[model samples]
Target: MPADQQRTDLLPADALQGKQLGLSVSESPDLDRLGLLDTHFRMTLGELARTVIIAGGSLFYGGHLQPGGITNFLIEELQRYGRRDRPLKVCLAWTVHRAMTQDQIAEQKDILGLFGEIHFLSPVGDRLDGPVNEATIDDPPAEERSRALTGLRTFMTANTDARIVIGGKRAGFQGSMPGIFEEVLFSLERKQPLYLAGGFGGAALDVIRKMRPEYAEWFPPAHDMPVPDDRFLTALERIEEIVSAVQWDGFENGLSEDENRLLSASYRPSEIAALVGKGMGRLLV
Candidate 1:
């Protein structure tokens, strides 16, 4: 069907209507060298978010809050094109907000609260008391912090109808597993519709590399990509090993083999958004 006709057919019964779509995005520090820049990353995400918003769905955000950061960038885009009914919902784990000053915490809440509801999630164990601040509270052990992040992602994945994963750092992350990796794994286990736009590269591309090496032809050579530490590599391999037990050839995210192939290769925002929209459209939801 033609694009205009597809939109017309969607009408009031749009598959995207009222859906809580999760977004997992960030940059690989070396993303610019891979042919996609920070500007490119935001634009692609903005376009994807816009598409979902226009169809009456909302985007779930779980990112760090800072001046002119990626989270604020998405807010600005939503301000330009989003409706009041489709406000952006942001989730913050304890570790994320704890790193901020009290003033920054208030500032972030004021800003994001204007867009949509803000979820302040607690750590998996040992809840802290007092105002959220970096100085007042001691940082949890690396292991506990890792579990907190996983708890947050698990909550986000469980709540959202589907998930879209983009760029992310694969190493030196605070979690036992990389953030995006945990999200993807949980999303797969829950059988949520997963859209991995690996063309932009990062952990998402690394996932494609591990699960579908043939798709690497669509990405730049990984020779210059940062080599992860043994711990990170070990974590990644173990996660992959666990996910592989499902005994599937690929992620069963409501897309066919050919569609997923393109989803892993295409860097264009319109193409990526279209494919995601296509996959979500196929869902029984």
Candidate 2:
């Protein structure tokens, strides 16, 4: 027989506590175009952190029950901070448009439950403005689009000093190499710290070298991936060439201070637990 499964309705109560504190535009950082883009990605990063806290680290987060960028980063950061075994508390806010369904929510809950807590977002039926229908990834109307991104931004910006911190990695100026370039531009303008993944392509690195030499430092020393072939070797060589051309500080290691500071601040466990469910461990309330 397949293993028996049971359901538990009682979730930890401390799952949602921290409130967002928005910062005045004047008090915000001096963001260039790239900085603006980083801010957006950082917002997502914040969301990810929140998920981890709710799920309690022992499990996954975001209701999808998978380890998202923020959760993985938190796990890594916590390990870096020397508390690898501690359990974490977290809260989450997930928005859903009418176009999406309850079944979808259930599925996501199952996933997120694998890691932490999740609070789904819903505009008052007919009470809030804008189209309530869910829009596809390709063509979301302006109002619908705003509906999706604004609440999180407002919550995050207004709650600048939120207990949970937020940050992300950048590939030079692009959000993530080999992805959407426009979105990458937006991520940069937001001031999200560039992060280097081991697998970033050499050709993509070359573009960064030509366009924004200053950010080339985020790339770490590259190693071969599971796949071994002439093409991969050639790509690795090209990436090395790009890294060699840039004169950025910590090019072979990680982000610089100003960048790292933001990352550090946005990843506090207490704060993240507020947005994401706290992970497995003792809950202190």
Candidate with top TM-score is 1
Please state every model's RMSD to the true fold in angstroms.
3.5, 16.0
Per-candidate local distance difference test: 0.73, 0.31
Q: How many residue pairs clash in all the candidates, one count each? A: 0, 79
* Model 2: residues with Cα > 4 Å off, grouped in runs: 1-96, 122-140, 159-285
Each prediction's TM-score against the native? 0.84, 0.29
lDDT of 2 by residue, 1-285 (tens): 221111112225433233221211111121232234433444444444434334332321221123554444444443433323333222222233334455554564454343333333333112243223454234445455444443433333222222221222122211112212222222233332222211122333333443444444554324542343443344334444544555331121223434332232332322323222221112222
Alpha-carbon lDDT of model 2: 0.31
Summing lDDT over every window of 10 consecutive residues in candidate 1, give the lowest-scoring window: 4-13
Q: How high is the lDDT of residue 45 in model 1?
A: 87
TM-score of 1: 0.84
Model 2, residue 175: C-alpha shift (Å): 15
